[model samples]
Target: MTLHGRAADAREASHLAIPVGSPILAGAHRWSDDEGVIEYGEWCLPPRMTIGYEYQP
Candidate 1:
């Protein structure tokens, strides 16, 4: 696959992995590179508010 194609595939995979109805905390994490970037944040379930990874892929 080409570089852009690979990036898009990764982005799609990350979107698919997240559970529905989770609340995401903005700016929880960040990443950058010469070609592309991705950010990871935190999300939580209600009541317990268990933290989980939120991906911006």
Candidate 2:
């Protein structure tokens, strides 16, 4: 077991990748071509989102 220890265990199993998330939507989505609909929408959090997949260990 040597080739630089199997390339350092394949770069530590492809580098310690973790901690990443996104889902606080709604930052832009305004439309009003002469008042046709939706205007000034914004959300910092709370829209309901939960499917699954949040850890690699």
Q: Which candidate is the best by lDDT?
A: 1
Cα RMSD, each candidate: 12.6, 18.4
lDDT of 1: 0.37
Candidate 2 structure quality by residue, lDDT tens digits, 1-57 = 011111122333333231223223223456667758756553333225333357877
What ranges in model 2 sit over 4 Å off? 1-23, 34-38, 46-57
Model 1 Cα shift for residue 27 (angstroms): 5.8
lDDT for 56 in candidate 1 is 100
Model 1, 54: alpha-carbon shift in Å? 22
Poorest lDDT segment (10 consecutive residues) of candidate 1: 1-10
lDDT of 1 by residue, 1-57 (tens): 011111223333356454443333222344667866665454222222244467897
Candidate 2 is scored at a TM of 0.24
Misplaced by over 4 Å in model 1 are: 1-27, 43-57
TM-scores of the models, in the given order? 0.21, 0.24
